[model samples]
Target: MMFKDWLKNKTTQLFFVLWLHISLLNLFFVNKRGIVFLWQNNSELNTLLTHFVTALTATLFYIAIIKIRLRLAEKKLTLGNNVFVFGSAVMLALIGFFLF
Candidate 1:
């Protein structure tokens, strides 16, 4: 399906939100341990690469979340939409803080 058309579907919206939430959570925990391990081991190249990859992935996720929020905003805001958008925003913001 077209991206815009896919976004308009309620099932797609819910699925996107759920998937994003799980992925972000997994990324945060896994990255945290990996980064700490790398830091302690003092591997400069590996540490830098880890940070770069983490930042890149997080930035892509951030952009996708923004797109979802914008598309949802075009419709009347329902409780479901509010929860999904705001929850994702809060999670993304927390992850941003954790990263930097």
Candidate 2:
């Protein structure tokens, strides 16, 4: 398979795993310490908005990392498997933010 095809498949699989794991984490640990939700008072709209903004920012950062990874991959600068690894890490971080 071509490198682009391999990257596409790997990215899809990473996304699936990331979504599944993050969903599970949210279901099991959303209110746990150090999570943003733990500090939020859900009754207020402004507080909810703040949390939304925070989560959005985190997700954007994750996307930026993914973009950088793709650029590195395009340039053949990253080592074997490191691109997927870094992408997965970013997804996990976004998941944490989502859970919060």
Candidate 3:
């Protein structure tokens, strides 16, 4: 309940969405193939592709989360909210690409 309340704030919503995005991508995307690739002399293009996939997954999660939260709140989804969420998601995804 407290956490949900905290998520209602604009900054918290952005941080929560972004952090979840980053953490989920980091947690599940790693695997044996990925490990082997990174361990080998992987090309920059391959590394870039991996980051792209991670960011895409994170962006999808962020959008789904924001939509679900809005639905649960019984609020009518608005254009402004959608735009804000999208922009935030894009920014977070880009940052995640660099960080991961």
User: Superposing every Cα of model 3 onto the true structure, what RMSD results?
Assistant: 10.8
Candidate 2 structure quality by residue, lDDT tens digits, 1-100 = 6977986676656555654554444433334464454333444577555545655554565667778878988998866688679978998998899799
Model 2 poorest ten-residue lDDT run: 23-32
Q: After superposition, how far is residue 87 of candidate 2 from its true place, in Å?
A: 14
What does candidate 3's lDDT look like per residue over 1-100, in tens digits?
8866764565445655665564444444356666322323233566546655655666667668777777867876445678779989998998999899
- Which clashing pairs does model 2 show? none
lDDT of 3: 0.61
- Measure candidate 1: CA RMSD: 12.1
Per-model C-alpha lDDT, please?
0.60, 0.62, 0.61
Name the runs in model 1 displaced over 4 angstroms.
1-43, 77-100
Best by TM-score: 2
How much is 24 displaced in model 3, in angstroms?
Answer: 18
Off by over 4 Å in 2: 1-40, 79-100
Superior candidate under TM-score, 2 versus 3: 2
In the order shown, the candidates' Cα RMSDs to the true structure are 12.1, 9.2, 10.8
Q: 82 in model 3: Cα distance from truth in Å?
A: 27
User: How many residue pairs clash (N, CA or C atoms closer than 3 angstroms) in each of the candidate models, in the order given?
Assistant: 0, 0, 0
Per-candidate TM-scores read: 0.37, 0.40, 0.33
